[model samples]
Target: MSARWAADLALGVRLALGGGGARTAWARLALTATGVGLGVVVLLSASSLPHMLAARADRSAARLPVAEAAGGVDPVFAAGRDDEFRGRGLQGYLVQPTGPHPPAAPGVDRLPGPGEAVLSPALAALLQSPEGALLRPRFSQRVIGTIGDTGLTGPNELYFYVGAADVAGQPMAQPVRGFGGEPARRGLDPLEVLLVVLGATTCLVPVFVFVVASTRLAAAARDRRLAAVRLVGADRAQVRRIAAGEALLGAFAGLVAGAGLFLLVRVLVPRITVSAFRGGIFAADVVPDWRLGGPVLLALPVLACAAAVFALRKVVIEPLGVVRRGTRVRRKLWWRLLPLAAGGALVIGRLGTEDARDPFVIAGVVLILVAVPVVLPWLVERVAGLLGGGSPAWLLAVRRLQLDSATAARLVSGIAVVLAGSIALQGVYARAEGDRPPPGNVRVLATAFATGVDGARAFTTALHALPGLAGVPVTTHALLQNAAGEKFSLAVQTCAELAVAGCRDGDVYTSDRLAPGAGLWSGGADRTRPPQWTIPVAGHHVTAQEGAALIVTPGALSTAPGLALSVNATIPAAGPDVVEQVRNLIGWHGRVSSLGTERDDTSALITRVLSVGSVLVLLFAAGSLLIAAWEQLRERRSTLAALMANGVGRGVLARSLQWQLAIPVAVAAVVAVLAGLGLDWLLLTLLVHRPMVADPVAIGILTATAAAAVLLVTAVTLPALWRTASLAHLREE
Candidate 1:
């Protein structure tokens, strides 16, 4: 606010904008701005995700049939006949109106009439494809119309509504007055909450680390510049204000750039994710959560200013000059480990409960993950000091690291955090994917209720007509009770139908001779009634059925007049497509599923979220490392140039650069892997209470990513190294 402070701030801003003797200032500023910008894009997108998913959920819930509404003045009978073709699942329903003027479902102008079907655009396309040959039998009804976007959660949904004379085929059919129901919202269970928390933390923490690192770029050069200002009679406070201004300039630019990038992503993402590869959302859904977005807007500049000013705290910038401290004192280790230790204590204290989602446990997990970066500096410093090699390139890198390893640590701290967090999250995801019920032996089944002998016969004939079961061995079964109240299940077929079980036409079977007056009931166990006929009094039983209970021929049960029974037809092969084809046969009366679809969807969701975050994290980390490499070059310009002038080959300098970053990052990667698995194991043993399952694939992927980042930094900086080491630039400061 004061004139002096204002003057000093303006001076620092000009210096950062490259007005002073700093030749590499423009590159440094770009690195900071770019770092902040990338972080902003990810943060903004993460904030918008909840709102986007909620919108998708609302659309999905809008079309659900509400059976409770069936009793309203106007009603329609509805049954779900959802099916799958190939590996792609589809939504479908069979409906018939009980009254005139029945309400239409969402996305359709009119309710379908008997013998017609309304299809979604994607389904219509599929039906026209050559692959539809296998699916055409299931939707034999005439195509009268198509469902619109209003009825679908995403553009590529396969959905249909077929008109039927009656909804008797489905077990869940009931009259529904109309279709809208409340959104099917469910709160995240504890494991889900844990995942969300970890997901958010992993994404944002690295950004903050990046911001802090970016603001402190070219620390040695900044210190020297401040010393010159001190020599010119500017006091400590004014010098500090100048540094803060320079940092703020980059942060401000980043904030603006980030806002622009976020908007661009909103427009581009929907267009790119247009199909089933990943579900696409409407542009309207990409609105940020102010709760998270607001802080990112407010904090970046503060972090920049604070990191710049704080780095100056230990350096005494006197009028004469200051010796830029690299390793005057040994790095401390105990305090660095304190957060991890304390957080672990808190988690262990709360073990065996809601610890997965418990705030204390979450806090502990954060500390442990964050500790990867904190402990990294100490680890790198110690390891770099002990490292030795005969190779000239390796010697050059190690000697320099032995002088100032903290720089090496900062170079990959963001990388370590991102990788460690990713591994822990992946472990939990693998566990969730595996925790499913086993599949059953029956691949396809069809069932329906029948009211009379005639109804039973019709249902039986319909079972025989079920599409996709041609030439497949089929058995029709029913559960029945006797007049004496004993219950048993029966499988009946013509002897021709029993050929699969080694029976011929004219084969006959009999049951144990019952007490006088005891006979089979026409109804099932759920509906016991009087005998349809008395037990036979004959002393002889038929031998053509081998005296078995198998109803190899219908004549076995025909003697009991009026044998009405419900029906179920089973084909018994649990191979691929068997369930879908069989389930289509039974239609709405029963469900055919392996329950694996939901698990696949969940896995896809995890992949989509984490895969994007991992990429962003990689880009952020790699870019930051590249900047650090450039900063090192600028700081050592005098040394590197003099070495080149003395005939040190460019190859040696390049290999040294590689060794400098790779050494520390390699050590950090191992530390990261241990810390990540340790965190994952703790969560699993205590919170998830599942077996400890480590994902080697996750570990390998993240480790390779970190290595790639290190390699990228070295490769990109080598070109800059040659430029910095030119003969014309060889001058001692």
Candidate 2:
């Protein structure tokens, strides 16, 4: 506020704007600005993802309002079925409304009448193909129109609206309401929550690393400059102001660049469509709201300035010079391990607990992630101390790390976190997939509802003729009264085929009679012997006691007149193509209501998201490492040049740079691997009782990737190091 203070602040501002600096100093400042700018760009882009997805979802929902608005309304006519077409699944609905139709949507000009269907573009394309002939007969309707986008179908899914008569059977039950005209806004479900968390983790972790690395760029040069000001009698407060000013300069520039980048990216994002979503996000949605974006843009400079001032805390600035004040107290090794221990304990305690919330699990994961950076510096220091004297390059590298192990560790911290995540996810994915049978090998169950015995028999015969079907078991339903006069529905399968076709249990003919006092009768010794005729109950007796007992008997079809027949067939290869074929053939005789395959689509989706997250993390880590390495080389230019002038070979200098980068990364990688394994073990115990299978190939690849990233970064700095060690650099120093 005083005149002198005002002058000092102005001087600091000028200095930040390159009032007195070498060309290289300005270049380093530019690099720092660029890094910060890109970090902000990435942050904004990631933040906009949720909005973009929502916009697309809204667009889809708007097109299917009739389906959306059907809640609580009884349908005049309705029929729906799920079947596979070619290699894709298809969901078809047939409706004839007695009341007013829904308002026209974006995709459909008008509703289809009898014998006509409106299909999604994807379905329309399929029907126009040669293979569409196989699928056309089932619908038995001409395609009248195409839907552009609708919530009733996924980007990759097939959906159609047809006349009521197009479906094979009369409505079995009232049609479930579709999403009404209003877009159904819902909070994130469990799976979606996991996706958002992982997505944020992947995007933000890199930004954090970039921010830290950028603030540290040319730190030594900045330190020396600040030390000169202290030597000239500037107080600590003044020194802090100068450093803050310098940081703010770069941060503000970065903020402007970031905003520009966001706009530029928004221009291109609308053109890019993700197959996972089956569409591109609207460009307007990708724009960040200024109410939120404004604060974020302003906060970066503030944080950068704070980081700069914080870095100066350990220095003792005297009128004579500045030196780092050594501390008598050392950070205890055990203190670094506390977070890891606490996190591991939390995970172990919570595993398989009934009331465990997802937030609790995510918190545990956070603690584990935090512990890596916390403990890494200490580990690096200890490992560097253990390495004995060797080549000059090795000694120089080891000594440098021992002097400031934290900085060395910080350089590779991003990769350490990424590696940890990738390894843990790999273990979880492997264990999840291992517990299930391979897709091609698992069996599929298809159930058909037929009107009578003849139709069921025909369906069974057709199922037997299908290429992949193993067996067709047909059963007849009838109401049978027990001696107690309690009636239950009985499903009768042939006694001769019971051994191989129906329930393989030898007690198939045994009576499970319900008693008045006791809950249910286990077969009595007297009833164990095969009788002239036996009834086998198949479902829950308590529920069955309310109705007729479901009995499986050989003579039910012959004796029980007018009974409905159902046939179930097992197919060995339950691929979409095979399932579609089976559905088509069975449709000729009966309504095929339910078809289920062994494949876990949820697991597949999780795997895909994990893969994308892993790739993003790798890119972020690699970028941070590259920036940090270049900065380090620039900071050590004087020392490297002096060493070269004294006859230290360039090769030794190059090797020293590699060693400095490698030792800390290797330590971090080992810790990461252990942390990853521990996390995976805890997750598996919570989710399933599966063996911990370490995928060696995945582990090896992750380890190799870490090493490759370090190597590549080190290589990038070698040419710069070579120039820094030249005579010109020495003279300038």
Candidate 3:
């Protein structure tokens, strides 16, 4: 029996291959392979993730400095300084050797001395670029070397090591003897795991749908061919095996094509500079795990074969003609809806405090997502039945779809699932990011340096000198109080700094409330008096601005004995990079923030990814849809030709083709959007316990994107429609 099956399968492959000059047969095979290949690539990419993550983790672990090892060979004072430039994060280590033979940094040749630095390739390039002018001053140390790949997980990682004279007292600094340690073993929190699972699962589902659809592309033609084979005395079981054999060839070819495609994408991964990915991945790390890959490679062909065989169950190939069983068989609504209802109920849970990790919840979500395509055929059939009253193109399209709405629905299902998933994810993502706080017009930075008055003056001068801060007025004031146990407080600023105070540059202005010859504490108003200066000549008294504290220009304190003033620099409307530059100048322990403005890097990254990723993934669905349309065109070439023979213009046939695909696509998009919104609302309100704040912008983008994808598919299939409409095909039909 096995030998007989093999013979029948071999015959089927040859028939599918069309060893003779069979143009239509070869086209169908190629289309099937291309569709399946695209899906295989996605599956391979999903499987590669584990290896990619593990490789990255291993590299990250290897580069971590071991803090305070027992019997260390050599120790160095190390501190972590995480900084950002133009939204790209850079990891830096401040190193100070504590021993004669200090260990070198992870990728550097040796430990850096004071005034020297080692930079990553990416950072080195950025520092040399014209765009890095604002960031250049932040790393004032001379570049001695570049970090090697061994120390970096990603090619685009911004990382470096800079020499520090002393890191002993700096925040987060510690003594480290070597670099090598296991990465943190902490797993993701419950909510995070749920998000990850949902994201990954939702992403892969459409690919699988596409693959299943691909297996049965041009099924009508294949079934007719199988009927001809039956005329040549092929048994029913042999016919099934023969069909499976055809699918096996396409699936095998697709597997090879997918591997090549996967490799091509892997090569391009390093070039992706998305901030959310934290620098792009290394091509070498983007390997598919054997355990996952072996199964995937094997399963695709098997699934393809199975799908082909299963599709044949809907049609019986007799010696006379193929008879499609499902045409007259009404699709039962009860069973189709049972899965959706059960999935929704399980997924939604009991609204209150159910854990995200609940097995039923996750399974329920999966079932609901999977059920979209399941109920889609029925939905499309109903939609098609209701669709009426239009041009000949529309009427023809409606009639054709009403004949085999299931096939049309299955093809549209790929994008529908993706669209729905993307919308739900976007809603959750938007809520997760939260609403950004309204930014203050003025840039408020409170930076305190341990450096005395001379350092303070130099810092103030430096802030004025920054090119980015050109034309920006900077106002700084320091509190100067009396030491003679006087009750009044004083603030010092130049006339240009504050127009309200109106103190001239060299004016020694004092408020009318100031006591005569009050002794001032030069070191500020502290209990322990370091030194005192007498208000020698209290000449002019001006109106106090608002309260007891009064303004004095910096020139007023120039000649004061033992002068020390803590300054607060508030540069109104400072540029974005100016804050980071200020942060660099202030270094560790300094506080810098814009009042009322919040910056969440993770949230920002997620927003960026969602906007870009949805568009990218939609492209995959578009490819599948395009192949489906082409296959349908090839299968119905005779029909198109017959229409043309009946005096129907090519333009009308073209519009008919468009209508056929568009109606189902439009319905699918609407269903997807509505389903996504509903799912997002349920998840947010019940599971996540957050308000459903639907992002209209994201929704609009997703809708427009899906529409664009459909248009693209429709446009690409036009040539096929034109070719299929040739009157010669009528004779063939």
Candidate 4:
């Protein structure tokens, strides 16, 4: 901590980094810095996402003015339209501003006047296109300005903001409140948070592993240098300080490079939009917050230094030579199973409980993922020890792995995690898609919205006219004025339909006062008082109260003043095209959607996200594995040269390298696949009780990809191995 000591440490760091004019040493240092820098970049980018997304949401919310104060109540009027624009369906909003637009809102130059609208930049660009002109007339509005990062539209979606007066005479079926002063919420939901965590974990895990692995790159050379320093009258503390200083220097350089990379990426993020709920995130939202980013940058160096210190733990700096102290206590295989056992127990326990949150399940899965690497070293050590004697190449590779199982395990850890994630995601996707009804048997529930008794009859007639349609049930509701002239909505459906729809006691009613052929009436009478008549439908014996008279048939619909007509029909053998046609036909009158469409859409989105994450993780993992392999080969050059001098063929050495890489990878792949499937089963059992389905194709692809990556990395490093095995390397040694 003294000034003299600090100056000495600085001198040592400079000498270590300068590499005493050795180009190979400088190159190793540069590669280490590059690895650390890349890791830092990914970490910072992932950390910034939530903040960026929230900022976009805030900007969009700010576009709307505060709600007007209506005496004691705040009056907020809003309208939305679901229409196709530029060949894409979008939900558009119109808000009644109580005051002028806020200047702080992004992309709004001024408040939109009646018949004038503010379009998102994407929508504006589309509207200005020649193809967009053909659709412009239908919107009947002038685009006054463009909004950027509104957060209400996707990259391909069309979203426009207009004044409430533009939609004054139009019916606003759905009301949007809470758009006033501050947006009620600004953050990710539970599922979104889970996904973000999952993505970040997947991305940054490999980066961290690479960074740690990078510190140990050329470990033999580092140990020799430290040993020389010890022989020159330096104590253990001084040697450790010098080594830490070297790591810190590389890490600091990496942090700077990473910061530069992040800034460059920030500029490009605005151009790339990823779709999710509330539209997708814009580039502007992805800019790293310095508060969070600063810590991440600072942590990288600390972690690098710590890893360096840890790697040096077994290395003893003696005057004679560097002695790596080997552990007397061998790691037991059962110790590795503890995490998996605990995680499985947690998952099983959670399944017995009702309303378990997703985070708990994610935690359980994470535990299982963590166990893969934990158990790998022991497994590799045991496997390599058992399979030590085969061909000369096999014996050489196995003995090398057995000698340093920890390093062998580290090489394939990334691939293990990625493989496990892919398998688990495949299981989840299978379970989700399994619930989807088969084609031709997919039920289509068509709902038609119309007004008046005549409209109900017309809608029903149109529904029945469709070929291959069945269960053409129609329900009509009226807004009735009571004796006090107070109006309330009442649904008119027969007792049979009400029973089938699972209406509760107070939710359904029948009356003897009604004509024999009339349908049942509900929800207009006071719940505190009894009605004049109470009767049950033909099938159920439980119904007691008759709030109002029934109008059983469409012929009796005209007796009451009908407010809205809801006609339901089912198409059992409809194809997607036929279903689309039905939807379009019903949409001509009102909003229409088939049953389970929303659920299916959500499941598909989740599947896509998981699949993408798995692919990215695999790519990153492969890159890390390649870097580790190259570094390992470089460190083992002297050993390889010695082997070559002892009559070992280049081909045998090459095969040995491949086997060394392959042994850990093959073991990790099997463990990962099994762990992945188990995790998937636990997740599904806890969430939804769907049957377990193994995806052999996905498993095969994952295995083949991991194997191919190992082979490719080995092939790429073979030239390095050949050079290391030559007389030049032996003479240098």
All candidates' TM-scores?
A: 0.79, 0.70, 0.82, 0.71
The order of the candidates by lDDT, greatest first, is 3, 1, 2, 4
Give the best candidate by TM-score. 3
Model 4, C-alpha of 178: deviation from truth (Å): 9.9
Query: Best to worst by TM-score, what's the order?
Result: 3, 1, 4, 2
Better of 2 and 3 by TM-score: 3
lDDT of 3 by residue, 1-733 (tens): 8898889889889888873338877888889889878877777877887887788788888878887564746788788776666667778788888767877556789878778889889889988999788678767899999998878878999988888885654545688888888876655443444455557657777887888899898787778778889998988999999999999988888888888888899988889877757866889988887798688778888899999998887787899998887348767777887767887898766466446667787777677777788888888898998988789988888998888899889878988898888888877766655644565566565554333345567666776676665544434334445554554455655566557454456455556656446666633234375534455364345664654355666655555634444445665765676677776666643445556554544344344544555555678888888888888887788888888888999878888877887888888888888878877777777886778778888788887888888888888888878888888888664
Which residue segments of model 4 deviate by more than 4 Å? 1-8, 59-67, 70-78, 82-89, 94-118, 124-144, 150-157, 162-207, 273-278, 287-297, 325-371, 388-396, 420-589, 600-615, 638-655, 673-733
Misplaced by over 4 Å in model 1 are: 1-11, 21-26, 68-74, 97-100, 114-149, 164-168, 183-190, 272-278, 319-322, 437-592, 595-608, 630-642, 695-698, 716-733
Which candidate ranks first by lDDT, i.e. highest? 3
Model 3 is weakest, by summed lDDT over 10 consecutive residues, at 471-480
Clashing pairs for predicted structure model 3, backbone only: none
**Candidate 1's error at 411, in angstroms?**
1.7
lDDT of all predictions: 0.73, 0.64, 0.74, 0.63
lDDT of 1: 0.73
Off by over 4 Å in 3: 19-23, 69-72, 166-171, 181-191, 292-297, 325-329, 349-353, 435-450, 464-613, 731-733
Q: Is candidate 2 or candidate 4 better by lDDT?
A: 2
lDDT of 2 by residue, 1-733 (tens): 5776566656655665553366766777777887788778877876665566566567655544343344445443455555555535566556554445533435666556677778876677667788687776666677788765543334445777665542323423233334335555545333333334444554465576667568767777676677778777887898888887777777877777777877988887655434443333446768665565567667788788888888887776666656775663344689888888887777666667522246666666777777887788888888987898999999999989877887898888888888887787677666656666554543556676554456666777877787656464444443334434354444555545444343433223323464222211111211233221233234212323223343344433333333444566655645566667777776533344333333444444445545665676687678777877777777777788889889999999889889999998899889989988887676665534457779988898988998898899888888888877777666544
